[model samples]
Target: MTTEASGTSPLNHPEPAARTLRYSAFTHDPAGGNPAGVVLDASRLDEAAMLALAAEVGYSETAFVTGADEQARRFRVRYFSPLAEVAFCGHATVALAVALAERLGPGEIVLDTPAGEIPVATRVDDEGAVLATLTSVPTRSRPASDTELDATLAALGWSRGDLDPELPPHVAFGGNDHLVLAAASRTRLAKLDYDFEGLAEVMRRYGWTTVHLVWRESPELFHARDPFPVGGVVEDPATGAAAAAFGGYLRAVGLVTSPARISVRQGEDMGRPGDLLIDVDPHGTRTRVTGGAVPIAEAGGPRRS
Candidate 1:
């Protein structure tokens, strides 16, 4: 299998596809959480090949493990959505970390992503569960422009009154930009039939990864649902990128004081319940997202031809 990495065009495309792995991120059960595709040995694959395999996996995003520094335990990783390559993907990162831990013996791995350098730490718990935590790139949040907010609302079929007065509309970035909309009532967040093409257009215009719909149940607990039309998925069961972004948004909006640990419950509405733990530092720009992932035994999510 000749590849661009060796200054040659790839002749056998199926070699790369057979190496893909399928895992569900943010949950220990394969049936729960967001499904992610990981290619641990994607060093031989190019961008176009990665994108094609990601589409074939039919997941929101896939993480390709590329260049590596074995001495430093650092690796170059790339994220590709079904439609295009993205800067970063949090759930996919978690899934990749756990998958790598199984082979690398689980301690710490640094990932060089397009967004920035990400540090992931993996630990085996007392119950023999592998937990992976990813520290996001510097995160920031800003109030959404009125025009942007209006268009998003229109696409979501939501009016101004449906929004929470306290949690105003904002664009938050953990690794990618996500539109954070706080619903005043949990009921409003439950029913989420939206205009797919309309939202995808708006997201592409604003460079948004997903629309993060949230409802605060308590100070340290929240419920979340993500609309990922831009990724060619109707909804992402669990969104680690948005959760990291939300931690930044909470601190920016005075919703939480510094150095807070909160839990975001997601995928429940979709019957694939997963929980993401977000830790915000008092002085650091990075937010930490923690979750567990398990491989799918039945389907590997790659079409080898």
Candidate 2:
């Protein structure tokens, strides 16, 4: 296996260095959300270098802005997990948008990601906080295969009896694919003790980025937990991609009556609580996720072992 250092020599060289910024996404408090590493200018770095930086950052995922068109406020963004590159990441995208908004002033920004083009709108709140809303690519959801569902439940130590019959298991996609498993109760969702390797294998086979474990509190309120074994993380504090996908799932399954705005409370079980706002249009194909991010005080540097 190639080590991170051997994969990229840019970190050792002096010229054309990249600057990384750390931000906690989906929350105004730096300590209350998912932290993501954002490289504002990564045009000089190759895939190997980006991967190395992501691994060094030790975050579930990192956002790299490789190319930018200043006049149009457009950028080419890539996402890297600690273990591999992902097609898209919701929290990282929101973090990158807020990071850019802080510098360029809040407005609309277009991001070209591996999955597709995503348009993000940023605005300053009454409290002087920058919030970003990203419209995802067209979303779709389908019932999970019996084999995959059974295997995933076994890996999670959950049984069919533990599932909420109203919200059936599904494979949902907004920008990336996720397995949506709605637990019968908040207690069932709280007790998350899954076999990491087992879940990772299942996720890899299905090309799923995360397993969205959720419990509905009401028509518009929910609590969610995401198992991101594929990213080498046991759980994600905040998951925007999964939230958008879940919106699509709710609409697809007829759980939602009309165009609705849903609020997802996540990370509470892990003690790093965050909130995500999701908007589903009755006539639109895509879902929009909104959240706020704050910059972490720590300067970006080499990863400490």
Candidate 3:
């Protein structure tokens, strides 16, 4: 596999470096969705190597494909943040799925993540972008304890009055845990100044991957903003894992009808608008998050290793 970088040949790059591909997930535009790094063949890279590469890429998370069974379309995917390994990263998963679809053709691919087994379906759109939908692990949610709510609110500089009365705060789990806090208005959701260290401390203590901050625009429309200080990101433009968790939160709290499909608009405040389509099944606990991803401009085209 050869990807010609400017002023250099990929042949000279050894191992995982030559296999890295960058993409933005949850949007067809590069300037939209959250950027992610994908290493299609990381068979030779150790945990240290992966972490270093992730820091160098500086994306919210980088997905590394450590093992694969080509004929069965099954692979083991690991996600790494700049600072540490993440249990699961939905945006990176989508990015990797689309990148693989471009080379291996649109189809279903199974990923074994640290969180659980994930099945992603990919298809090419009319605009020539590969759209991917990932079925999250079993989702669940529970009301946040008073202590938890108080700590998070203190860190976020938000009070109970600022929260939506209809959607109560909860701890939701998709592949990982997330604190679901619904802002009373879009204005409240947009202004995102918070104590990063304080929030990170709270998140770490609670084992939360992100604070799934959201505002309900309508029965089916919503605006979301995710503060991912724990991941070493000030903000995440598009967060598929959190979106999936929020879906479970919504359904659990009776905010949406079962067998619902809702649209989540995120990253708009950051100028990188991304849209996620979440489908929550009435009978099943798993949620499906759908979106398209685009190759980062500098990567040029399809790459493989």
The candidate maximizing lDDT is 2
Off by over 4 Å in 3: 1-18, 299-305
lDDT by residue for model 2 (1-305), tens: 12122223332233234777899999998888788998877877999999999998888889998877755788889999888999999999999999888877899999999999999999999999999999999999999999999999999999999999999999999999999999999999999999999999999999999999999999889999999988878888999999989989988998877789999999998888999999987667799999999998984322222
lDDT of 3 by residue, 141-183 (tens): 9999999999999999998999999899999999989999999
Worst 10 residues of 3 by lDDT: 2-11
lDDT of each: 0.86, 0.89, 0.87
lDDT of 1 by residue, 1-305 (tens): 21134322121133343387888999998989888988866876888899999988888889997776654678788999788899999999999889878766789999999999999999998888789999999899999999999999999999999998989899999999999999999999998988989999999999999999999999899999999888888888899999989989988888776688999999888888999999998577889999999998766331221
Candidate 2 accuracy as TM-score: 0.92
Candidate 1 regions exceeding 4 Å error are 1-18, 300-305
Model 3 residue 286 CA deviation (Å) reads 0.5
Cα displacement (Å) at residue 43, model 1: 1.4
Better of 2 and 3 by TM-score: 2
User: Any residue pairs clashing in model 1, and if so which?
Assistant: none
- Backbone clashes for every candidate come to 0, 0, 0
